[model samples]
Target: MNRVIKDTGSKYPIIQAPMGWIARSQLASAVCEAGGMGIIETSSGEIDNCKKEIQIMSELTDKPFGVNLPLLFLKDDSMVKFCVEAGVRFVTTSAGDPTKYIKVLKDAGITVYHAVPSLEGSIKAANAGVDGLVVEGTEGGGFKSPVEVGLLVLIQSIKQNLDLPIIAAGGIVDGAGMAAVFAAGAEGIQMGTRFVSSA
Candidate 1:
């Protein structure tokens, strides 16, 4: 089985990008039902609301799902505790260093994948013992590095330097784009804009 599928426990190697506000129970549960990994987003900084959504996701779908922790936006460790207490099995950390919460999450048996826009970040995440990488290229929407490295080059560069599973994010919207990322060495794909319109 594909590493992403195995790690995520989803039927498809597709992960929905945890876009703020948009990535909640309704869309996430739908993604889970459709066999893709659904992720609850904490980027909105609405901790209480996000927790409610996580609880709602449990009632909405039996399929495995995940959550995203954008570290930079966090005000405290409450979000981490929320995920661990909620029994979340998978999480993607972004907007900060992966090392900050790797041990705590891993200690709770959560699989961790860090979002990165550069090879340096990828290396740092991999070395931090994250289970995988969400390799966000410059083309990806929302917040990203100022440097403009396209998906192809970014994917190839990370794959060449690290053996961690790469979930390519940025500019992928269809089967053709997914195929293109896989061909470049990514094991899975994360789509934000496409999924926003999808649900």
Candidate 2:
């Protein structure tokens, strides 16, 4: 099969959403083992704690995985540097503009994926030179856009307007949902609720 996302040598396009406080090492490791990219949420912003989590994840499996960094908590470039030093090859940035850290992560040869809730945000992130875009729709839990666009609509909108690969998120709960996203022109799908149940 032709997987949509190609980062750090992993072939599958799917990414397990890095739900803070819910996405534990075991869960993340499980996804990676299943041929999809797993991500640990280090939203805590403490470099030391993040490092420990990275180490724990590393021990679980040697497969490539990523870390989610909330841009709001990162300061003074510590989190960026920590990811680089920790040898993480992929990172998903959210909660703030991720453009500022693009060059830093790119220089380290890390692939940076930014999250967006609207077409405008997707365009901005693409203009900011993100390697990929995770388009989160209204059905997604946690903080969401006031516009409340659904995944299907957002995917089509992003694909029409942006050249960057799009990772669709929100209300995806099964293999059928995954297939539907790929049919809708999403390069990949990010699943949060489904993974929680899997764990």
Candidate 3:
């Protein structure tokens, strides 16, 4: 539908955020089936288990989905390599500097997206040459920054200085919020808590 993220073959700019402890293959598959990108959050276990989840999710849907590998647990290069080998084309990294793994993933031909809570973090990710930035505000559930920037301000701040496509996360619940973010200059939007409560 002519979204910046859609350029990568996703039908919708909407992404089902990887909810770590709550993420499942079924949930990720459902999002993909619904014409949105789903992401498997692999933060709770070993690389092998994460690899298995990716494989299972891939088997469940031919559509493009992604895996979230928070840098907090990336102890070795094997996890990144495992993602590449598992045929995961897109990755969202959080909790640390994405630069350390940028070249490795890029060389493997995977699109890298970093999650940031501030303009400074966004700038750092841009400088590292990530494909996109998911600008998450404090309202988003889970490990949030204490800085307390809301969606509108955070989105605008990142938009002003970053060249990469910006995806707004936190407090977006439906189509109206989605429309608003696009109008605000974000190429895409990510919603975590909203999806978790849906029937």
Best by lDDT: 1
User: Where in model 3 is the C-alpha error above 4 Å?
Assistant: 1-3
Candidate 2 weakest ten by summed lDDT: 1-10
TM-score of each: 0.99, 0.92, 0.94
Q: Which stretches of candidate 1 lie over 4 Å from their true place?
A: none
TM-score head-to-head 1 vs 3, winner? 1
Model 2 regions lying over 4 Å from their true place: 1-3
Candidate 1 local lDDT, residue 109:
100
**Candidate of highest TM-score:** 1
Instruction: List the RMSD of every prediction in angstroms.
Output: 0.7, 1.7, 1.5
Question: What do the candidate models score in CA lDDT, each in turn?
Answer: 0.94, 0.82, 0.84
Candidate 2 local lDDT, 30-69, one digit each (tens): 8888888889886755567667777898889888999988
Candidate 3 residue-wise lDDT, 1-199, digit = tens: 4545653467888888988766668888898888888888877755676677788987798899888888987777777888888778888999899988999888988888899999999999989989998889888887888889988888887888866888889889988988888887788888899879865
lDDT of 3: 0.84
